[model samples]
Target chain A: MRDPVTTVRPAAWPKTPALKVGPADDACNVLIVGVGGQGVIMVSKVLALLAQSQGFEVKQSEVHGMAKRGGSVFSHVRFGKRVWSPTIPKGDVDILVALEWAEGLRWLPFLKAGSGIFICDTKRIVPPFACLNRKPGAPMRYSKETPAEVVAHVGEAYAIDATDMAEQLGNERAANVVLLGALSTALDFSSTDWERTVAEFVPKKTIPVNLEAFRRGRGWIEDARTSTPAVDVPAPTPATAAPYRIRLDINPAWCKSCDICVKMCPERCLILNAERIAELAAPDKCTGCRLCEWLCPDFAIRVNLDAPEALAR
Target chain B: MYIETAADFDVTDYLRKEMMPHFLCPGCGHGIALRALLWAIHDLGLDRDKLAVVSGIGCAGRLSAYIDANTFHVTHGRPLAYATGLALARPDLHVVVITGDGDCLAIGGNHLIHACRRNLKLTCLMLNNEVYGMTGGQVSPTTSETRLTTTTPLGNQEPHFDACALATAAGAGFVGREVTHHVPKLKELIKAGLEHPGFAFVEVLSDCTEIFGRKNDMGSSSDMMMRQKSEIRPSAYLDTVDTPFRSNALPTGVLTRNDRPEYGAAYRQAASARAGTSS
Candidate 1:
């Protein structure tokens, strides 16, 4: 590890990495870096939302930098004990995912020591000015560039032309999903179940092509591992590992006669009385997702995850 | 086969199936304006199938696709005209017109005034992003005098039109102006507009990230959103301000609300008279 004083310490850590079967911890940080409108943020959100669905404390930040002009964009995502910041600072990122090769170097500063596993695309986006300068302003310019030579100084790297695979899948938009697949192969996360997360992020219509891209991406990581050393990052820690109960509480003063809560409850657990006051019909059906709390206009309803039965009464 | 989870609300679904002529520049205020309108629909528990969203040809007009209800992407500056026909034809449907500054006050200005004058039972959301963003930042009727657009290199020589004041004067039953960034308040105003029985006009102050966003050095779409929170005063106090027509004056709410005779009621009366004469 680097000097503790220099390193940006995480706000909190789980007691253990629950996903790992051995002495290794089940935790790793993955940074999704790419140009805007290329689906960098979408990839990160899909992963974070998937992790969240699996009961993992996933913290994904909002998209940063100029996303409109295909400029650089990144989403720092870490899942463990309630992630706050999206950035990993410098030399702390476990996986450096570059949708484009130039972006790989731009974000290489965040790679961890002896642990910088670069899962990057060999594609290159030569911007408008580069074309004027007579530079090789072309897409997929790194299709032949030696991935090993590029990252020889930093650490180990795995480069894949995920764009070609995505194109073969029929749509170029699947390029990011392919990268996610490669990531799942390198990490201990279930690549098989990754589709569930991908589906959650994209609209239902775009799921099939995205699934194919994800499969291709995962296959690239698995195939590349035969020629390279496997990444030794820890497995993910699930958020629901610890047993916790939930209960519902309502503040009568903030209640509006809108009946939003009664309509919002999926289980028909809430009922509006003759006077329009909402009361519990079947409080036991509450899953405590806090969707009701977030949806309530008056902010009258709350979910007590800590004191479940106490608040329910 | 079955995908089960929460954290719903996807924008692409709106983009793919619904939103056509998708030219509402990325991060534009039109998206927020549309979102507020949809939130109003959701909050009011309005029947999705019974709702009809009509729009004119501008950034705001693209909203017909974003809403998951019956939508009509009418010709430029003709949303109110189409909406009037639709509302009168299908009185059970909740018709909403999403128009822009240029679409409403310039090309469709006559339609808007007449719609309010006739007290048509419709909710009109005129998004005032100041300039005509789709047509390469041209000067619009709602454009501030000193603002620089593509056509107005130095400054606009033409005066701006106060939409809320004009609608209130035109005998609209309900008229309100809200900045797009004030999402909660905007949602409430739109919900109230839908609930009203007659012509309800809501002027939403929005931003054009592509044209007006850069010319005025308004920063990126995200930075321009800060003005909504900073500049707009609380509705409770601002609505009480007299001389609401002054420039830079905070937007007011419910400018005019008088129970007037509706156009549909008059039409029905005329139809009954004609039926009796024929008999």
Candidate 2:
């Protein structure tokens, strides 16, 4: 594996200036490759929707090959002054966004030689066939490879730990949005444009965290660009400050006792009581992060950081 | 056997004559089901102006386009919701909804259950060809585990939904299932469903000869019709079998019929009662 320190190389930016206007002959072709259920379709949809909102003609096609069963899925998105075809011709893709490292390697042939930008999620899911023990006279064809190795083959690829970043932001599913954020930096789109599209596409409850994930991704790229050469760039750790004391109060009447708050607590600080309502099991472990509050479908649970007892503590 | 000809069975009065030459592929059972529906409407002697047919997007959904009536071709999996509104507003109109397996059981599942629970006065005819024919034969909710589709290359491991059983359990006042091969019986069921006061759900086991049939090795259109004729047993035979579906015996008749209070009539009654109490 290449050094984690060198993974964030400084001179990896595109040589050509990012195109602002969609030229007739030079439509940008983006190929998003990932395993099924990785939200690759949603990412392409958001891209197409955003492009259409900006007065560009967009054509998108998705191939769902055994998508629900952890098989390969990809979408081709072409946008320009006038997009004629839904598919991008082979070897003409401008940007290749792979949600998995192996998928990046698998679809590398689609990228244009020497000029294409490869952005890959550093998450690797071992396919089922790869993990099965080999039988006599029959060998397994699957092998594991690092993101660094994939980046090496692609000549210049950006490897971002999008899943880890999304988990840090309290939802792993927002990794797709995080990749979209990194994509926004490579393209000539503004944050306001992305924000508006995110609001329009993402669910109303998830808008805040998804937008935060997008900004974090954009900021990560910005930091890599401005930093001095050879300086080791560490992953951005969002501020996680826990109050000295906190209390969780669940309104028993409102609580249908779905056990969502009890199950979703990262610290295991909440529990279901005999009445099947949520009860604070360990107040000291409560971080006041409000994950329970956000996850609770019913607005029954409340995190009280400013209780008199908490203040006294 | 009765030899019927086009001249004797002229449904020209109920068809959009100009829209003909229809778009359904040869050997498609959707056409058969459409003919059955048209025959049911003609048999009932229903006024053409008072009937409204709604359909969602699919090969089966295209039935609304060909029928010469007040038809609304809504988005995929949403015909039931639209028909519900039309039925409520104009209770005099007989609103019928046509949908495919994927459109009704997969995407429109919530609306289906709610419509049944409410016992709305609407006839929902779900055509189960066992594949999503319009999208080039993707495996749908009704596609059996023994079958294969583009998405299920290795064979479908997912359990299929029993649409008739689901509708029965969801509180539909009338529930029936029939194969397109049994056109006479299918038409009778549709006619009975149209007369039912509450939610009437009929599942038609249609054939997709081009996509589903070719993939499953179910030979020509005639072969499929023979299979349907031999496979389906009477409703009484279902009780004697352990697993009717596994035994290759599907009951082709009215499965359930109840007399639930229709939603529109109940709503109006409640509203008038409330008004009386306030006065």
In DockQ terms, which candidate is top?
1
Q: Give iRMSD, candidate 1.
A: 15.1
**CAPRI category for model 1:** incorrect
lDDT of each: 0.71, 0.78
- Candidate 2: which stretches are off by over 4 Å? A1-313, B1-9, B236-248, B277-279
Q: Clashing residue pairs, candidate 1?
A: A26-A235, A55-A239, A181-A218, A182-A217
Over the stretch B168-235, how does candidate 1's per-residue lDDT look in tens digits?
Answer: 88889989888765555677788788888889999988887668978988876556666655666555
Query: Per-residue alpha-carbon lDDT of model 2 for B72-159, expressed as tens digits?
Result: 9999899999999999889899999999999999999999999999999999999999999999999999998878899999888899
- Residue by residue across A224-263, what tens digits does model 2's lDDT show? 5565222222322222343234556676755656564665
Tens-digit lDDT string for candidate 1 (A95-159): 77889877887888888776567778876676555433221122222223355556556555667
Interface RMSDs of the predictions, in order, are 15.1, 25.8
Candidate 1: what lDDT? 0.71
TM-score of 2: 0.45
Q: TM-score for model 1?
A: 0.45
